[model samples]
Target: MHIEEKQIAINKVAALLKNSGKFVLSIDKNKDGFIDTGTRKITVFPDTPAEMKSYIENSGLLLIEQFETEFAHIFIAEKG
Candidate 1:
């Protein structure tokens, strides 16, 4: 998708999550993708949108909890 399309899609997803009081957790499946952890291959929960990893921080939901797996990040958010 183009940049605009991608932004729109992200916005839509953020709206849905925010409306439902849900937050999205982006996972660094590669592990090395995140700098905080090095070669550990463990799941990490990140609060900041550092390293240009994800824009879910802009989802407009409050981070309540987080979970991690080999494939994805699991996040729970509370409505503000």
Candidate 2:
């Protein structure tokens, strides 16, 4: 079976977040995004979904939350 573009995109996000302990809050907007972990906050901007996913998945973590806006996506996930 072939994956749809949107699912592929989401799965990509999942994979990266799975591997990487960290993830850029929101990417593709060209502006830095913010994330809060109850104890800490982080801001980042990944060049692309692929890039962000690479970082997130490679870091060795799990769980991902995506906030969808008309302009961009907001992703939150666990850190290792």
Candidate 3:
């Protein structure tokens, strides 16, 4: 996904967690337009969700769907 879409996804995941203690954020590139299916480097900004960011940092998880560059993807999940 592009920058705009990535941000939207992150926000949606954060909102989803507001009602639940845990949540997972994923995208199907085959339909989402990201043809590069694999782990794309996801950077954490100061504004990134605290819980989700923490999980990523702690686990150093690779949240990318792997395949071809045409199908870009990333997967992030958190439980606490």
Highest TM-score: give the candidate number: 2
Superposed model 1: Cα runs more than 4 Å off: 1-7, 17-20, 23-54
Cα TM-score per model: 0.37, 0.40, 0.27
lDDT of 3 by residue, 1-80 (tens): 23444445555555556432444443333333343336674433322334334444454333332222343334445433
RMSD of each: 9.0, 12.1, 10.7
Instruction: Judging by TM-score, tell me the better candidate of 2 and 3.
Output: 2
lDDT of 2 by residue, 1-80 (tens): 01224345545655655444554465445454655669986664335555555555554544377666766666676755
Instruction: Note the clash tally of each candidate.
Output: 0, 11, 19
Q: Show model 3 residue runs off by greater than 4 Å.
A: 1-4, 29-76
Off by over 4 Å in 2: 1-24, 28-46
Which stretch of 10 consecutive residues in model 2 shows the poorest summed lDDT? 1-10
Model 2 CA lDDT for position 76: 73
Candidates by lDDT, descending order = 2, 1, 3
User: By the lDDT metric, which is better: model 1 or model 2?
Assistant: 2
Worst 10 residues of 3 by lDDT: 60-69
